[model samples]
Target: MPTSRPNILWISTHDINPHLGCYTGIWPGAEQASTPRLDALAADGLLFEQAFAAAPVCGPSRSAIITGCFPPAIGTMHMRTRATPPPEVRLLPEYFRAAGYWTGNTAFTDFQVDVPEPMYDELGDHTHWRLRDDPEQPFFMAFHSLITHESQIYLSDEEFAARTPDAQRVQKADVPPYHPDTEVYRTSWRRYLELISQMDHWVGTILDQLEEDGLADNTIVVFWSDHGLGMPRGKRWATELGFREPLIVRWPERIAPGSTYAEPVALMDLAPTMLAMCGLDVPGHMHGEVILGPDGRVQGRSEYVVSARDRMGEAEDTSRSIRDRRFRYTRHLHPDRSPMGHTEYPDNLWTWKELRRLFAQEAQQQLAFGEPPSILTDLQRSIVAASKRAPEELYDVRNDPHEEHNLAGLPGYADVQERLDSALDTWLAEVGDLGTRPERDLLARWRPDGRRPRAAEPEVDNRDGLVALTGTTDGSTIGWTTDPPTADRRRWQLYTAPFTPSAPIWVKTWRLGHEPSADVPIAAPAR
Candidate 1:
């Protein structure tokens, strides 16, 4: 009998917002001439206007999407922090694999750890999809594109000038009010749109390939971004522009063409929705609800979406936000710290540098004139305020869509703030958010002694010029290094089979989520 399951293809992009032609009606000039392919995709698929990521940064947001749980709840909220989930906590792909689906992912896992062995039959570049053993078997695959990453904004001014001609450039008036209205800013926006156009072409190729392979009707195609645009006060902020994403889903078998869903949804919901569509049971541990099923209609209305911001690189801050239909409320745990506090990564961006340079120029002009030196635009003041956050922020998104005006302390909005605050509290409690605690406090909670859970010392056996290493932990893997244990140096080699030894070696053992065992030296065997 033919299988009833449909194939799944997830195409993810980096640091892009809902700037497509479909969303252009809402965000004017977002639709550049270069995005014909994406415009076509939106015309053919269901466009979700209110989809958001659980966190602003890539690693944490991806963790939430993959695991279907809030990153803070799983101790994976910090940027670049890799935490292996306990064996009991299965990932989204693992669930599908267990349900007899062939799963694969491109080289971009982006979760900051090894993809569990059971999660995918193949895990590599885009070509891995063609390497699946059985083409007829239902498959789930993810392909990630990096064309619109923040680093793309680093193009030289000459390059920007040469690449985007006047006719192709977005007008300076179209630049967001929060950003400076300068040639450099407009050039950056044009460059980003060009990259988006390039990304759309690649997406069209993949979709075309599916049709050529006769799998278009049997495949469910999803395209979205990890988070939002790679701009200052965008990528790392806990604002609408930071968390909102462009989500489009095309299932030829179920969904109607050109449908739009405005109810709030999140990247985390993708896992459960896919499972439900595949006729599998949703796991109890997942925090997201299924937003769509086999019927291809909106499953239910989601009233609110929660997002977070935490440590990024050397900078440290904590913020939580809740967005209901018309209002957005944010609470900053460390209101005293600057929102732009010394984050090296974002500081290097041309957008950010230009913003700072403009601010400095204005300040210097004021100082030269011997005035009070307080001549600053609302945008400039807002940027300054970002450095030092208010304890609470409430915005009527319908009226102040850019979130410029804070109404948390206003008289008439007390009830709105209180209601959202209560909802945020309930969510924090339910998710067990460790973001409320300091970094040291979180570390102490995870490990009472402030030390990692180390694996037991390995036993080394050497006989007849052969070396064999054994680990005491039941599921631990043995690794070896030729050098002694040092704070900065340790190259571990996974021990798979017995091998003849040429020199002395240090052996250790480790299991995921546990500290590696102390190094044990193994001497060379005598001839």
Candidate 2:
């Protein structure tokens, strides 16, 4: 390894919990035992057995990871609600960039946070790492994999069959008790496991490339998921399954191989941990503490980790949760609202659709007149009760790992509940959680127009054989796509410098919290 700063490779996958073979001890039967690459990676690194995300959803969770602060505290907790960070805030990559480290990130959904140009030397696909001008410079690269995303579960039957020829279908009896035991639910579970296997292959490819390039030993590879699975009572809930993540860190020169840490840690700590590992100071503004210090030794364990949830898609709600080694406590600010409220994203899931069908069928059975009553099964009734939760909940996680029983009002758990509630109150106050306020109020204060700020049109200048693209909007980043302006945001290229185009293309610009500019056609330069 180089005597100077070590190279950092951060790999993130979408929507998964610690459902690998290693975590089977914690979540028995959750593992499909199919991720050999990740299993091997775990054996060669330090595994964090109790890592959790600051939020259950992607945008808010990633915001916390990048900023080392709670998303709600930084005004970035809501999904698809983009905003520029406050002037006082400094992102993690910006600090690395200032420390002479080259920073880059592959395709990511920055739906809630705006990454300024100075924060990254490269922002595009995985090739950005190779495109760096100085190969010897210490680099911080983040690669995101979307194969395990929730949308993968929405694959058509033919697509699912085509992808999983050898995959084993999970039995309906293996489905968690929280969900109904049905073929639809079983199919969804099996499909998710199949995706996990496929994701492992993609992860293996990156690891193989690092080794083939002879950079594996010098690079500190960190692998983790953004949040939890995108199923009912997950992703948006403040439960253990929603926030817990699988984290593996490998640094052959520093960290001991095949070690495990059981301490409770939040994803926010990653930014500070990376800075500390690179022999840099943890910024005072960062809310997270360094879990791994400069000497590559374990720091003091976090007594508890806190997580929060706000608006998701169109449904608005607020929740805060605190989890210790033995217990998980959650407080829902809007207990009156059902968890089944219309959220467009999750509603697309086949399991969610099946649940909705059952809910509607049960509701129809309860006629107003003297009709013979058709009753819901115990599992269905439990689902309904969970949809409309109590204002406060307390779970003895050690005794009820699945978190099925609520101990908030239970007589023996009063003291436990009070202690956790106090801890949560202190955390909320310290972090300045804005989730306590209404979504509309926050929007009005931040964006009075009730819409994202608009960006100015991009100007294209053709000089000789080169094409230069500029945007009139200050602080906005320019991007171009061969496809239409409304093309997938992931397909657009982050514009940094002028280039000669092989063909005519469309250009657009966007700023955080702003609507993207209309696409402008750029004709190819004539000879």
Candidate 3:
């Protein structure tokens, strides 16, 4: 018999926060979210209790998983992607392609290429794994479920009317106290859960096809979400829900059935592990590491894993985070701005309407009691503002899972706060993150011309403590750090170059016009 390499299937859903029975241990329905497929998949493989996406938002987070690098490291901190991967930066699929595995992406490929115009294939339905059933070739396929996308407009009036109030109650059952308890809010939750059910059905269909093709045993299946639910205190930060993902890794030959690993793991760690499991090189550019030894023993890393968020959708400069399973600490340069919505992006509009109704209800109750309307707490107000965020936030995950408490200034935890802050600061300095706004300003200054160069855009490569900026309006150019930037460099790097799929460009320290640079040879500077 010929030696066989396991085929890989990666399935991702948008904005799901591990609400499935397999991860949350609480399903929406009386029997739990009806997910026979995912439950079966979990039974066959290893389940990761503490897994995180690279970033909390979609575009940037997805990019990090594919490339095994940070969003800022690649100048892709912005949530919406107009940047293309440089020729030198190979995505995971491309690597598999090089290794002779047929690769297919069904739903989304946030990474773009150098084509001058959008390819004719661009308009086709997102890539599907069904295309990868070729028996002659080993394959890698990725599919994303998008019905859970963050938007209140996902429901029809008829659908909302048809749902029983009891059915809708579960949506609000998981609601955090900080948010209002109202029917509008409750109804929104119902719609969202319905979408989750739809996603479950999709998973079932895919699983059936895999079995029919006799690829079930030969394939290593991985199912996860890009981030948490599209709700407040989720998706865009280092909170448990934001980073905690639903991971079902099934490879029966290598992994025993009904196995669960509580050891905290970063999603970035998955890339390296996959490469190692496939018996391929974990490229030098990848910052992630494999958790399991070749002998199949678990070789875990630190007690804590770091999660980062910058700008996304419309959100602006934020900061990196460090969490040690119990506590999360973050440091922000923009103290005045609400960390969440400084660069606001329209979010679940349905939730917004629900909040408005809550506000009205609260006010009416206050008047009926001949009392003043309760003023919103800082945290509650921030949740309602949608775009509001704070420069600094600290939470003890054990006591406050919703991240409602910001303990940055609580006197009792001074020592813990100092330790976390110091650690976070040191990591930023070592990683060459001058700070979000400052880096933005530098990239903008380097690209003075309205247009950025598309062909030679700077990519996230750490070489000699200097990064490069390429594809200037005048052609290939350079940007470098004469001195490593401090917290003052956070500003948006504006350029005229169209942030299109074809004409890629970026802002960084090394100049492409100058002598070429090499990858940063050491691990990122420690905080």
Candidate 4:
């Protein structure tokens, strides 16, 4: 039981859409997805019907979530890059910890270009609040269930067959119209839903532990996904399928059970909202708004939620989009680059392979018939489109949820296009898209030499019975351990404040996206 502050548990799943039973008919046939635990959880919680991620992929989406700033604003937009966030960007956990909350991550999931220091008091595959030294202390815990990640879908067909049960397997998969209907594609979809079911089980395990420990009533449990499904035209695109995701929160003390909030919200809004809920001042630099908090809902649809799809691995490109209730507007900055089909990572999935296969076969037939074929959809060929057809797009989501028809140049919609287009422009001007600058230029600035920079040596002094440590480099932090070498603590404990050790302690210095300093010993206060 917590004394004053409420505990926060963030449950994040990777690469999924709102495909649970609680989201009934959000996607046709999603009711059959079989997530009993999540369904029950939502039944007793608040379900957000229109939540969108800032990015379509994990690294960028998670970056925005942890930083409370759009990745583009902080130079962490591109996927899996080595860019460092500017110093003074306080992470959400740091604020909680400063307020005397014990933060823990059951396993690591930050794929942002920048990493936070003093990340967690405890971290491991099985780490839990139960393992904390003090049970009464309120805690911020995160559990990322990776069973639903796209990589799992890359398993061999035989492995999927062996792992799946007949009852749970997808039959006649409700294939998205953009994708071709084929046995191979259906199998891949089947495997994905099965994985979601497995992820639901993981959720049950964590929630069960919380209740088992008598912390259920006071803890706020939030379940969300990094992005939408990993299929083609989904994870790497800026369409609704790629950006919209599920967000459900169960706060027994604060929430009205079985209620739903349908206003649009950006996933990044979560960081600032969590801070406000904990009674901390939200940093002004954060781009997200306080949509929900202790006081009550900050009602109204977000004017527009901006999203981005930047370079993923070797396939480099950029696209920006903005979505309001009924319209989605997008601009592709680099259509000449290779299509998402050529992206190295997701290309391994059978769905991607199916797109390429179906597109090529249809192309051969088109050449023979001397006419364009309707069999291969623009959505499917978008995987391997020689280049994007238009630099901009507009979709009326309420009318065409799948975004099959592009309304950018169509007649009689100039007001809608101009309004959204202006809103997106204003947002970019205010925040400044760092992603527009060439990635190589950013790399050179961060690393003049071929190597990553190292944190300056840490200096420590024992003055007036209080030991203090400082770092020369900006954004640097210290990690120290009182334990000896025989104990493999794996990593050192984060040094947030000066403390009198029982004896001497070892310390190392680290700066985000830079090498850590060498370990050195510091003595305790004199008796």
Candidate 5:
């Protein structure tokens, strides 16, 4: 008999904010990239209106979702792999592997955790899953699509021609107020839509393959983007457009059709949810919760979904946001950092790489009204660079869903600001956030590769026979014995992490660490 354990299929797209027809009204039935397959998935599953990414960018958010913890909490706060993981910190697939599930990650695993650690089976990109070593075992697989990625590489001449008319007709450009509006901008936008269309086709192919395998019914299929649309709102900051992502969970036997959840949910919550759906206990170290029903619909949104930022030196930002049906309140610990302080230049149009020089030329020295005389000053430049934002900005989402108005210092909206401020303060206190006050030096201390000792010889503990090596920085990568040393020079498995105050990392197993024969069990310290 076929087992009842739910097979998990998590599909993630890169740099896609909530621009789908069902999530944002701007693209509904529009000639611009239509997402019919995605829309159908939403209809069949529970659609989340306020689902947020763990971080604004991919590397951080991916690390958080995979581990079911915040990036900073796990020393993966930076955008890439920086440290060797502690042996005991389990991967999502590792937990499922314990439950007798065959785990395969086809597309992406940017978490940077040490490989050869025995968590998931990497099946590269073959599309055909039935041919695997174990066919009927329930599984967990993540497919990350690069089709909607920010690049001119995905755009073709035909697509460029198809969007040229709309490109020329954008009357005001409504260009995020932070970016430069140039012909280059319009061209990039035009090509971006083309890329989105391409993404839709790629998504359809994945769905078709799932059906072809005849495993669609029993599988719990979840489709979501890592973050927002690849525009100004895509890469950095904590604006509604940046963190909010499209989330669709489909399970025919579990979720009710055509259901929508308006409550806010963070990507951090996904890890715990997956674990719960599989009837496993969420680890005590995880910070997220499981809110989805067995049928793949949300029972309710989180009371509050908080996002924090600690970019590398460019800007040290910390923000706490709380959103209900009516209000979205954000308290910035370092309001000065705003989006303008970062070099990511998310404001550049989607395929801006094609016209990078042209956009740079047009954007030179352009300043906003009442900007400082010396616009080069860091503070002044930030303000001028992001003219749309204020030190304290508030928006009544009920009236202005696009967040175009600034009600922070306004006469009538003072009450709203006060109320929102109170909410932010309470949340900060609860989360142990010190506040938005800028601490530039503290930020410097948290830099990914700031200062660290070079890896020395592995020091074997004479008492326990286990070799211990320390990391130089938060995300530093180091290799060590898979288990306690026995006789000779065994190969090493890479591990990364920052020290956890609660439990120190300790090794429990050993293996012949040499290449190819790198199969071994390394028990990490229990969190």
Candidate 6:
């Protein structure tokens, strides 16, 4: 391992399942994937075979990644709603900045909480580690790729042709049994695969830039996706396909080349793992435990990974999933509603329309994935029908990797169900499962009378030639800019330490959930 601190580069993608070229035979239904850059990356780095997201939806999943806490535990289980987190909790970047490292995020989105001001040294499309004033200082640079996002799966034909000319050859064999063979679905799936290829190109460009800047060798490159594929039963559901994520970490000094780890790992562990790699203390409040360090993988890592789902758009439901090595068990709290209950957002998807069509055909004794008389499989019916969902589902992932068969009802897996059920009960109690508290109650607490609490205005004091700024607000971070502030609020610098100002500066105090105080100006001290 290197003696000095290593720069960490985090690259996150959206709505992707493990269909990489490297996983050709390993992960079924992705044998045709062509990804040279990612293949090379896997050859030179550590590829985690069983990485899963804390939540299936993008917003809630991202909330878990940024906070290093499960959505249910942190009051961020809802899909797109914003709520206040506990005061003691801090975003991942804050830890890097506090450790005297330059932090930059090319694209920043923490949908769980309303972050009043930019916390990183740089944020936005042009943000980069090179922008840091001190070249010697270590950095944590993060960025995201939207090429493989949900919306891209059903691009306009003209747009799709521009990106992928050969995107219409997908067949029934390429798709799982859950989906019926249809032209619209075939096209959407083809486009999704091609986008994954393009996303690899995007990743290559960033890595190329890192090497061009001579930071590759000393930098730890971590690549991951927020969640899995964005099909009908993919992104929002708590199924195996929905929660699976691709994780690759390349740090040649410490991580062995071409190595692979098959242990189940949650995306929430990312923040603490990064901190551990950087030799920093992992905060006690974080729900994730560090999984890797200088000595490689942690001993006695977590046995099971848990995920959550709640109120996706207008769809109202709550479900929790627990996965051990060979099985995944899902318990739907609201069994009255079908797992296929419509959410306006995903209902627009072509695949969702296809699923609905299949559901109607099956009702008329017409739909089939394989051949005539096969009819709709139980998995397909469960996914597309408006019928009530089973209270619980258990899948033997080792035997049925697609999770088509539910073992919860079967008598043989009694021990498995009991063990997983107990584990889930224990976890819920330990975390206090803030999700049990009504979202309305949480909203009321976060925003009284539908208005955010405001932080006290920041005050600046001149100590000799140094400028010291503070606000009476108990726990607030400050953001400052010059008199003629730039239109882009992201340019505001965080006030972490006293500074000798070159010109007059403006400052404001901001807490996570509170409204930032009005900008107050401070004159430059005498030279």
RMSD, one per candidate, in order: 7.1, 6.5, 11.8, 2.4, 8.8, 3.1
- Model 1 bad stretches (over 4 Å): 1-3, 84-87, 157-173, 366-368, 372-376, 444-527
Where does model 3 exceed 4 Å of error?
1-3, 25-32, 84-88, 111-134, 159-173, 293-297, 339-348, 356-379, 385-391, 434-449, 452-527
- Between candidates 3 and 4, the one scoring higher on TM-score is 4
* Residues 469-497 of candidate 2: C-alpha lDDT, one tens digit per residue: 78787656676667654556434555667
Better of 1 and 4 by TM-score: 4
The TM-score between candidate 2 and the true structure equals 0.83
How many steric overlaps are in each model, in order?
A: 2, 0, 43, 0, 24, 0
TM-score of each predicted structure versus truth: 0.83, 0.83, 0.74, 0.93, 0.71, 0.93
Clashing pairs in 4: none
The TM-score, computed over Cα atoms with residue i paired to residue i, of candidate 5 is: 0.71
The C-alpha stretches of model 2 lying farther than 4 A from their native spots are 126-128, 161-173, 364-380, 384-387, 448-527
lDDT of 3: 0.60
Model 5: CA > 4 A from native: 1-3, 24-31, 80-89, 112-116, 126-128, 152-182, 295-297, 312-317, 342-389, 411-419, 426-527
**Candidate 1, 467: how far from true, in Å?**
27
Weakest ten-residue segment in model 5 by summed lDDT: 510-519
| lDDT score for candidate 4 against the true structure | 0.80
Q: Which candidate is the best by TM-score?
A: 4
lDDT of 1 by residue, 245-324 (tens): 88999887488899998778989888888988888898877778899887677798469888899999888889999988
lDDT of 1 at 526: 72
Please give the TM-score that candidate 3 achieves against the real structure: 0.74
- How much is 517 displaced in model 4, in angstroms? 2.8
lDDT of 3 by residue, 1-527 (tens): 12488778888888876666676543222243545677788888887766777677887677668767655655655666444333344456645665767666664666422212111111125555555446668877777767667653245776544432223223344445655555554655566666666677678778888899878887778898888777655667555666667878888667788788876677777777777777888887665668764434567776656667776656565667777667887766555655345334444455654555555566676777866656545555665543435666788876776677888888988888888888766655654442264544645643455344323344454445333334433322232222223435322222223222111222443222122333222233323
- What are the lDDT scores of the predictions, listed in order? 0.77, 0.79, 0.60, 0.80, 0.58, 0.81
